[model samples]
Target: MSLLSKADEAKLKGQLQDAVISCTERCLYSSAKWAAELLNSFPETDDDGSETDVDSAMSDPPPPQTPTPSSKDPIEARLEARETQKYLLAKTFFDCREFDRCAAIFLPDSLPKTSFLVTPSPASKSKPHGKSKIKLGTPTKPALSAAVVKGLSQKALFLSLYAKYIAGERRMNEDSEMILGPQDGITTNKELPGISAILEEWFSGLANSGRKPQGWLEYLYGLVLAKGKNEKQALEYFIQSVNCCPYNWGAWQELSTLFSTIEELHQVTPQLPQNIMGFVFQIYASQELYQSANQVHNSLAQILDIFPGSAFLQTQRALLYYHSKAYEDAEQIFSELLVANPHRIDAMDCYSNVLYVLENRPKLAFLAQLAMTTDKFRPETCCVVGNYYSSKSEHEKAVIYFRRALTLDRTFLSAWTLMGHEFIEMKNTHAAIESYRRAVDVNRKDYRAWYGLGQAYEVLEMHSYAIFYYQRAAALRPYDPKMWHALGACFGKVGKVANGIRAYKRALVAGSFYDNNVGSSFGSGEVSGLGGGVLDPEVLFNIALLYERVNNMGECAAYMELVLAQEEGPDYDESVGDMAGGVGVTPTTSKARLWLAKWEYMRGMYQRSMELANELCQDGVEVEDAKALIRDIRARIESQKGDSSVA
Candidate 1:
């Protein structure tokens, strides 16, 4: 029983003839029966050893064994040999990295013969009448060459150990034994890498390797590449990986993230699942990647054409429409979704928001109520209800709802501010002030709250407090003329006249006009040199008269002009006429004319002034005093004429 085939022996001797090949004394002749079985499966050789019956030889059963007398039977001996040969061939294929071929060998020829073992029925001597006796051949021992047995055993051991390694059960010691054992048949020096390590190395190599790999290896490689810093490289790898392995979720996830990070999401549109369309919409919505989002939306529509009953896809389409601001489409879809699933919270919120934005207040209110019924604790629903009440001027109801919203979300600043506004509208100044204070406490930099607080204090006549808030508001918004004017008025109320004037100057600098309600006007209680009161016609006239006394002719004329502009025809006559008569002028006469005459005379309009004085003299106005004043004006005019001539 030779341990090696004659060919294998000759090859070994030839290798030893070359001094470069050396084997230690421990190197025993381990048969390569498994290697021979694999080689035989390749094809049969011709007389010249060229493959002649290639396909047929590969399909042939294992070689026949020399039967011995001890064997059970000829059939049993041949069957045993065939089974041994099949095991050896499987082992050899596995060692050669031909896993597909190894798997194929294990497949049964037919369904019923698929079991690994074959059972034989017992022979019976009973026969029909007149049947002759039949004798069975004696069983014989299967004469397997020692070399083939050793090789087959080694191969079987290697395969068993490899299976354990692949199943993640082989210990490091077991792997080391398989690699370093004398009977270990694999030529590679390294222990068979663990499945995970092999997978990792294969992934790394495919990711860095220019050539493309296929199957799960390609998909895993793409995942590794996608995580790498080089995005372009990752993109290329991901495309290849997904193409190779479409079922790999890792590849899909990495592709999604990669496209999202670079914002080149169009690259992933074709591959995105309908289930993740909503996620895709969210990414584009956040980044404002409209074109890519639209493509994805279109893709979803295509998928829906194929799978129209997909509820999840319909929801995603609705969200896309919402993001695109196609409110009509969104409303339609959400309405459908709500009808289908009555308790859809997100759909309710989205539909409500759309209505709110569209200014369909009643519809928004209805939706908000429904949403509240669905989830009483939802703050957004409460906020929507508050907005509805606020729009209707139901300040009390608005306040209650806004407060409820605050209870749900303590940090809701807009709710707090809206609550303050409602209190203000309700004329609850103290409560308004407290609400604004709370808003400011929540957000110290809220300029609107500071302004609101200032207005509340102003309304309460708390001048100093008002000034404090007004200054804060002004500091936050220096360009606001209203704040400047309010600060000026507050200062004036507290008798800080100089400060008040400065504040007014600031208002003017900020482009405030001093007409009626703004800047140093008696109108609207913003008067200089006067107490808080409505503008009085007589007092204004007196102020004009005082301006005349102080030689401020321009100011005096301005005041008179304002009076004339306000006083209309006969009413002006009656008012001015009564005042003049009290000062000794006739009733029904125009006193502003007389004042104008005096002003004209002082302004060197002597001829015009004399004409006015003469008219008054002829009317018997102010009787004795009018005539004397007219004579004095006439004489003074003549003296001015003489001086002009001399000049």
Candidate 2:
């Protein structure tokens, strides 16, 4: 057997580890299992620590000459020792969702310690105590202790801590309702007391060490810091996590949820490392920001240029279109992805969402059936089924599937939001509000939940509270005209004319942007003046009404003119003897015309006023108001004629 050089051995192990990580990231568990088997093929090194043992298995069976200590890599030896440990098995268990089994593998004295760390001696029968480290030949079981867990690789340490955390959560879930009652959200729970002890004792002195924390260790520490509400420290550790593991999407996703506002995101942007991880993190941040579609699209284009084949990136692009309410484009992209990989259920939930919005019943039903056939247990599958039911207006059945999704994953944000939508449909306002609140708790960036909350409050006639929620939704999704329109409506409901006017102006701007081209990307422009579009006749009319409220007659008259110019509705066909058979004029158009007539009469433009009033009456719409206005104009014209004759 020929002994491999230390550098060669380390490089080989790194290659194997990278393969496993890549497979796992793609959720290719079977491939990961095969890779793990290949890893296991490399024989475990004995406590004596020799490259000969591992090399012997891979190469010739003949004995090899021992290399001198000076030629050995310390990292190589550490890597060998870790192979002898059960972390690999623990990791496998972690992937299988066997949290308790995974935790057990890392439990105290669980795995056999290799000869390098432990040696049996008849004289050293006693256990080592504090104040002194174990000497070379101490006879102790292969047990880990409070003072002994140091210098672990980030993955190793994170695995141990995270396993315990998951196990603790699973244990709590058995009787979660009894253990933690209603006020506590499912996404949050009390600290696992033992976790604190493990951090303080098992990871003793780690915080005090001079070494910078590795990514996963920093992630673990950040969890503790975040739980403590020590946001400053948590932010620092999370920043370190991304810096150290630039490709760690999970860490970036976690970091993305830490902030609730754009102001907070900007405050921390300078502190983030500006590498690919930070670049991707900014993209994640934008999902919540709801910036202009063009701006978001451009940023995504830069990343997609680097990784054109990434399904995750493509799904995000699809999501951008969905958020912009460009359902057709989003649906096309999602359909293409599914056609390429029919069994892939990754984002089918979102695809179903597009179908639901389009009311493509057949497509939605087909997706739900296919998703169920692929893997009914997945939360995405459940969501697709839920969406199918939702599209059918089967609110009760839809809620059940959405509930199942949440049961599978408490942090399933889409399930929570969708469930709230169903509750709203069923007129269960309180339940809808609660579900939306939980969605917000899971991810503050969920503008859907905020918008839902506003809708729920509005249904309850809580205008002030609805305003607060709508404002939050508007702030996050500034480019969404629906949010601006909502804010305008709510502001007007509360008698805030000036505020309502400003909000309507913004609504006009956003609506114009959406109407011009749903594909265009741009930030929400400031709005002192009104924007024109078919998207905003209602908004224009609202603005004109608000102006009238404040008695700004000139602005009111101008906006009213714009409203009439925009409405362009087909007048009711009173000529058809049966009114119901006529092409109906929308009430909005009728009211706008009435307002113009009143304005014209006040300006002594009696001819124009009578023309409009007569048009309204002849259309068989708003006849009573039109007749009254016509009478007043007649009286005024007669008075003017009488005065003229006197003159």
Candidate 3:
């Protein structure tokens, strides 16, 4: 008959409770006003007419007038009592912040009824005439007046929406999302529930009502969308949240993460939590916004005062200092942390890295020894020792440390990867491959291990295996140029000329991209000439040969010239022997020049070929081959001129 009546029927039928609450909320501006109106609306009929009792309306307890056992009408009083009880129950649930229970209470019949709410069928009674009598108790249900319904409406809707937002946030983590940088690898996926659909329903309901959701609701939705990789939607929600409540720190945190510049973060809120400040620094560092990162790091002391004894915050602060070239500050903080807790192997490793960068060899050695004293069998401690020796060009000692690390913990992924690197340095391809295999077994997503495998297989001339390993590495780190180059080389070895050409092209693009993109202090670039993931000019020379094999003479000559030009560049020297991550390798410049000379002679550029050959000989790189090429070119030129000249 009425909207309130319909809502009651819907509740009994276990449907439209959310809709009912939403509609009720639209009618009431605030819960307190609704409560006062609800209590005042109850009227009593006197001798002349109906009158409201102000005292009864003002107080939550029923009127002072007592209805005796033989009172005139009790139905209204019973309804009033029932409504008051239900309203109190709803209020209790809201007070406890158990919004889900409130939603469930309002929509109790929506799902299976609990045993307590179900009427039990009475036990059958046997009679003398073989007849059984059966009985069933009527199930009791709570009833609420329109006043009580309207009073609880706002809270019900708020709780329902809040619960849905929380559910969606939790489910979003199940989707495709990555936590850290490329090195952290991909996250595992979980089976999602119906949270996304619930969130959508909540939004749809709010939109239909033509009302903006609460500030916290917007924040939660933003976090959910962000976890789901819907950055644009997440950004919109985060902005809306901040616009609604500038003091919402959670919204500011999410907004800070989605934004690119410090200005965007400041727009969210100038005052941030220590953890949020740390996040800001990391974002700036990642985008190579060093100036901004340093600015934020400078405020670390003040932020730390608010969040005392947070090791994570302190460690991030130290890393920021390191990136800003405040190495002394970084080193000091790291030293303090390590001294406070000597078993902090990570701190020891980091401090050692900072010392290495500063070229403070004595301090680095002392840190390494301190690490050893803390835990000789710790994987990270051993790694620190190994990396130190490796840096000093002491391959044998590095191998011993790496081996000791593995012996202590075979499943240590870093040790396995680095040990393979050591083996590669020692020219033991077989041992390197085995170590890499173990690393892969420990963590298949480790790109470094895959790259090591690619190097070992390439050395053994197992081109197919090399291709597989390099492909894995490339999949994990698509930005790594060396992986693509190695893949191209393998393809060329397997006689897949077209594929080789494509891979080489990708390698060039990726290499240029890497050169332009700066990295964080903790990036792979920190340790130069140590990892296989580095630029290699030899890739250009190899690509040139691949072009030659395919008979693309123009492309072959163009690539050869590119190689020579690149070698002449200052940055080319840094990439000289990085290919295959091996030791004792000569620069590829000489070989590339010699190949270019031969290519020129084949293309009938005798004079140009002669110049390159003579230059190579004078430079004393591949001297014998260059001399032979020069003699042959001279002979060919004489014959062409009909001089018939000979030595």
Candidate 4:
């Protein structure tokens, strides 16, 4: 090579490094590829007789030489040294996990000043003419070489493909964060299969070239497959990654997550770096493996020295505490995080949850409103606002927020269910039914939705439909007394006496009629308005009527007595009870007591019936009927005495 050529090559290599650095810092993939083109302008000649010595190439550079007598030129060796260094620097950045930096060098738009060695635009190339034309004072630019054009194109293609693949892996975290509603519209156009195919092609090329993929390459390929939902295939590469480099924390984390049990991960846990233990802890905490979660957290805590001033770590610790139901600890940690960065939306979201669990609605609402003002589009903020309105019994306002939340994320099952509840509170049975059905459609496992559906149907007097929904709800929550009670009432309405009686008995045995263990995404807390009379007096009354239908007067009388006793007790507070859905429970009044008196007479308990009738008359209820019954009984008694005397 000539001195002029060697000098030009060295300058071009330096420009390539600058472009790479600039593009990488900005994460400009396409521009970085263009930068890579400048470095790849010249081909490196490999000796077929010997293996390529990558280490020697990276460590040593040819010294500047004087003129030599041999055919081998000193300038050529200098040119080769610049080429090797340029290539190695790219690889070094990639291996250091500075991918954006490495990628920037390969992008097309990253060039600060165009180099003569880079591929030139076809429009910029001037065609030869038979006659020379007069030129101005401008300097002439050199024409691009065919080899340089082809090499740049080849390098650019590979780099662009690699950048696209990296973008795909990045989308995994983006998709996760989107579902979490921390930000909006972070989704990219790259599909998983397309990216995976590109990665496989690149990896295959490396392997075919007698080179193994780097640890990060394998780890990123595994991420693509994992994101593509090919976990089984991903696992192989993930294992290969850690095998290639045990310090690959990402590989370790992915492997740890795939392990079904905490015991399965124990083998690698001790080998995990302290910084990576946070990811392992997240896995355990998310899966509710509390024992393993606690162990991992304690180990991480020791490593972080209790995270004295790191708000991020402190917030994570608080969430773990919240998951473990150490609400007070969670509250304190969240408070500290908020104090450090009071405008932190996530901290506010979590702090609101802590307040909700403590039933501090005012504070919960305050935090929720603040969070909403910060990020109105976030589903958690919408939910917090909705929940506050619900607590205040401003159900219409609550529904608006709940619907807004659902609009943000339709798959938010809790929002759907809560919306149904708001409709029910408004007594809009049809709308409630539709909302509850949507909840069930979103998640059939949500028992609250099923119960809401049942209640809505029951209100509309669609007894058969009510029975169907109640039965479904009961199946999911077999121990829920309210479900069984509602089922029994529906059966009675549809004239299924035997089924009604069976369901009523089940209701009685199911313990409390109210479900206090209401679960929510934020956390579990007490539910209100579902409790009034724990043992519904109306259910007993329905069972009594069902027995009376079969002339089982003894059982009927027994149940009627239970109803009366309940009505008279403090446990059966009438003020809180709502019998809006034709729940078959009537307020205990003169009419209810009179029905007991009539049933006693029908059972042939004449003397007992007479006593009850007399008491009813004295209480100034059904006086005419009680008096007429007494007169008839007295006449019958006199007739019987006369007959006995004759005999």
Find the candidate with the highest lDDT and give its number: 2
Q: Write the per-residue lDDT of candidate 3 for residues 422-537, one digit (tens) a residue.
A: 78888998878877887876566566788889889888888898899899887765655667777887898899998998887787666544322233222242211212333345
lDDT of 2 by residue, 1-647 (tens): 13345555455445445545744633335445444543443434463255555556554542223332212445424643674457678788888988667766656434334355566575554755343454443434334575445645434555667777776566545535521146336433333445555565544575565434446566666777776667787788789877754444555666777887767888999988875547656776776565434767888877665545556667878887777667788999999888876897887888988887676899999999999999999999999999888777788999989988877787788999999888988999999999999898777888889989998999999999999999998888776677888889899999998999999888777665553333311112222222332535677788999998898999998987776654443332446533332213566667888999988998999999999999899778899999999999999999989999999
Top-TM-score structure, candidate number: 2
Superposed on all Cα atoms, the candidates' RMSDs to the truth, in angstroms, are 32.4, 12.0, 19.0, 18.1
Residue 354 accuracy (lDDT) in model 2: 83
Lowest lDDT sum, 10 consecutive residues, model 4, at 521-530
Compare candidates 2 and 4 on lDDT and give the better one: 2
Give me the displacement of residue 572 in model 3, in angstroms. 14
* C-alpha RMSD (angstroms) for model 2: 12.0
Worst 10 residues of 1 by lDDT: 19-28
In model 2, where is the ten-residue run with the lowest total lDDT? 520-529
lDDT of each: 0.50, 0.70, 0.57, 0.59
Candidate 4 Cα outliers beyond 4 Å, as residue runs: 1-367, 373-375, 391-393, 426-431, 512-535, 567-586, 589-592, 603-607, 610-647
How displaced is residue 97 in candidate 4, in Å? 21
Local accuracy of candidate 1 as per-residue lDDT tens digits, 240-353? 654643333344445554542324564555554433223434343333222224556666655454335445456667755654445677678877877776654543544654
Candidate order by lDDT, decreasing, is 2, 4, 3, 1
Q: Model 3: which ten-residue window has the lowest total lDDT?
A: 522-531
For model 1, the local distance difference test gives: 0.50
